[model samples]
Target: MKLQCEVEVINRMLPTFGMRNRGKGTRAVLSVGRQEGKRGAIYLMICTLKDKAGSRYKLENNIEQLFTKFLGEGKATIRLKEPALDICLSKAEMCSLKNFVSIVGLANKGSDAGTPLLSQLIPAKTSEIEKPRAKMFITSKKDYPITKNFPYSLEQLQVSYCKLARIDMRMLCLKKLQKLDLSNNHIKKLPKTIGDLICLQELILSHNYLESFEVALCNSTLSNSLKLLDLSENKIKALPVQICNFKELISLKIDENDLLQLPFTIGRLSKLRLISAAKNKLSCLPSTFKMLRLEKVDLFGNPFIQASPMVPDIQLKIPQTLLETAAREVARYRIPYGPQLIPATLCQDLSMAKTCDCGLSCLNSFIQIVVAMNLHQVSQTVVLVDTMGGTDAPIICYFCSLTCYSHFLDKYLQSIRD
Candidate 1:
């Protein structure tokens, strides 16, 4: 197999000395095949970018061991014996890397298994066409590449200070993009097409004019890949309840917005660790605020309600409707009911099912109450919620049944009295 990738020849058995300390590799091509006219002998050849007569080694008895060490995405190190050399391959396409490694591994076994088909030894045409046209594109001078040579293979693209009122359609076509920064623009709305960037991990829309976090974005493939989202300095009044779909989100910054309250389901984001929502107009947190295990939480400058005496208002409708009972069962057991199995309205209602303190799911028939929560209990590093050195904030709670409410009332009252 022939693959074009970076190559590094390092002998760790040799002492670290002059000229070896740089530890950088060169762009090269690796080839694995049988030597011409040499029956039953496999050869591994590496050609540097500038040389054609590359170093060749006979695989029979020349290799003591062969194994692969993953460095990171798109990079790997192959260790070979006898010469005690490590061949590091960086910036290699994943498909090419896998094929190259497999061929060399089979050759090292010293059998006819080393003889890969003749066609398999040739580089794939698709790999040549998929070669990156560009890896990164950044601009802050308002010189956007809207019509010309837009980097199609870009993994990172920053188009800040461009005054772009809408997302560029060309950018959504970059399926390999990992980070997209459109900060300091005038964008008012995000295109649902933004979700086409299935590989995107960081999305920065700070200093924009956005008014709402669309549900389409939350339901997209981004729910799986997005790790960091910065929506700071926007005019958003409320985030969609579906924001909980960002299961992989780690850091969320919504500072200087007009948010009233976060989604009650946000606690479902099990990977979330950091949050910055300072200077918002939030009065109370969702009931599930205490469910988070956060590392850092910043709520300074927000108007959080002071702690009040616990009040229980038990309001439950007994003998729930057949639909409500079925919905609760589906939600509690996660029966995988979707729009295809039921009406769209019922599916929507089921998606919004509430969870009681007792861990059971409920719909419209539940008792509700309000209580104070100390922010310190939810996070390790917390900024004060108000100027009065207060950290207590009100959180709404729901109970699926009177039995669940009765069971929690004693512990809840005793804790609040403390």
Candidate 2:
């Protein structure tokens, strides 16, 4: 088995000899396998790119003692007896480390007894075990090397407090990148291409100069992969309605912004469980806001409008336009449509179609009513919206037809009269 990790060779007799170590460690590939043409002989190899000639030891009877010391969080130490050395491995995943430990233990047994261990220990080519894969990288300005290059194998990267104005193009090319933290920067705008990181799950962009969450990003592949998003302490004025496209989003933080309102279709984010919009300009929530089953919600320090009983207005029926009729039919039946298959403007109109409480789509022409709703109905933990400790807030409800509006009005009036 070949494992990529940071390796440090500590001489067991160095302290006794009154000598101090010169360097910390080097990124290297560790290989454990049997040598070819030599039966029942297992060899352990450590190779670093900087040195073509690497250290090798025969595990069969070469060791007086062996120790596997697991330091929590993907770090371990392997001590060899005869060599009097400590092989420290860091950034090695748990599974890989376990496999290595098992192989070394089996080799130490030196018995041809159990199922033949030689078959499992296949010799690796020099080219195959040269480059170490760096999966996790965290760097700050203090220790970050100017000439250091980011490994393509990186899965998580954090470069906070760097004062970067824009994202590095090289970072975007990391296809396997899953978590990225670029907080406390001077970035003013985000490129839509950030959504191309399909494996990305958590994105931290708090404490920046960003003015808006790019609408194009909401329409990208992030709608499926992104789970947590942080945009706090930014200069953002508003978020696009399409922000709800992230169906996998569980935690959303947009605190300290100038948001006027949330998306009316925010309930479409079925997986969302936590949301914080504290210290914003929101006075009320969307009618569909009650659809969320959030665990925690914070809307503190907002100027929420006082709640009052809504009085329904009876009006004549308005004829729906041909575009609106088509949009409704498309939305109702869940027809597959997009800009690639239809006009972009038509697609936009379809996307903006509203849903009535009765579960019918309405476009352009629809009865609109604002009613007070208790925020506690959707969230278990809610921050008080007003100093009065009241949780009721107004929400705008839409209806596809007069009949639907009348149906809702009847229920509303009856509930109030109770």
Candidate 3:
């Protein structure tokens, strides 16, 4: 049986019949060659422009019209005997023989020595043709091929802008598939069986509505082989603690989510070099995060509060050089008040005030009065006041800042006078 082979002209050009434009004459040429056994055929149609006086030609159109024309023929080559010409016709049979001869003369000046026309017209073997996989584009449109779960096989699958309601791994059993993109879909969840795809290296799940990831993804089978995982633009509130299992993960993107905190187990992902969690609602991070060996981390738009020393220290020690640098950063700024003073009303309000008319001297006096009014030291005085009040004790203001310093002092003096 003769194996049918396809020779598509991915790029082509037609020679111009008229005079040179801007001193350059347009030319087109198709080069074809084959190996011992006819495994497959390759047809390269190049459209070039050469200065009327120059010997070299410049390539103009990279996508040749020949491929489009050949696709319509359902065959790679066409042979004709009436004219005693073994002519290879592409989908664009519009190529004129006179123009082709002119292009050949311009492209191959010396090859005119003895090669026959049929030899030049034959297509080359498939090995000579470069095959570039199509880019994967995930979309949310309902009519996309990936939405219907066709049993199709491809090196790269682009399903961008598709409204995918759900994903069932069993239906997509493409064994040779390498890159799978499901971005811009409305998928709310992923099947745990996704780990079955042992050969998958790149998985893009960005711009989806996923709330949580399947725990099965962290299985050793998937984690050890997976290289890049994009889970950006999701509604995930928290990442699975098992994510640390993906020791081989080179890049993990979870940006634009509702995550409040990172799991402490994240520190175990020592191999992770890049992690992006920007645009989230994180308020605090675990101190164990100090163990990460990340090259870059994106934590922008997350309300992060510095952790206190009371938090558990990371088991792994940061290099002394880094610690010294961090210490220098801390030494740059010093808070005047102790941590205990943070809850004081005067401290809270005055620290936040942009401008306070009260001069430095007045502020110093207020601070002194507050320091002197330690209510915890006068338990007996508090009990006597409570007993005299009978049914209910009068609310007493204890702190003596600028707001209450004069009133407390006047009341004490009036009691003595009475």
C-alpha local distance difference test of each model: 0.79, 0.79, 0.48
- Arrange candidates by TM-score, highest first: which order? 1, 2, 3
Compose the digit string of candidate 1's lDDT tens values, residues 25-68.
77677777767677677777777635555677666666655445
For model 3, how does the per-residue alpha-carbon lDDT over 84-119 read when each residue is reduced to its tens digit? 222233322233433343333332333333233323
Give one digit per residue, the lDDT tens place, for model 2 in 1-418.
6777788888888989899775587777777766667755677888776653557777766665545556346677777777888888887767877777677766777754432434434434555455545465454567544576677777888888777899887789887899988898889999989999999999999999999999999989999999999999898887888888998999999999888888777888899999999899997788778889999998888887754335543332456678777888888889999889999988877877777888988778777777888788998988887788977777777777878877887897898799
For candidate 2, give the lDDT.
0.79
lDDT of 2 at 152: 70
Task: Name the regions of candidate 3 deviating beyond 4 angstroms.
Answer: 1-143, 146-153, 168-171, 310-418
Each candidate structure's TM-score, on Cα atoms with residue i matched to residue i, is 0.67, 0.67, 0.42
Candidate 3 global lDDT = 0.48
**Ranking 1 against 3 by lDDT, winner:** 1
Best by lDDT: 1
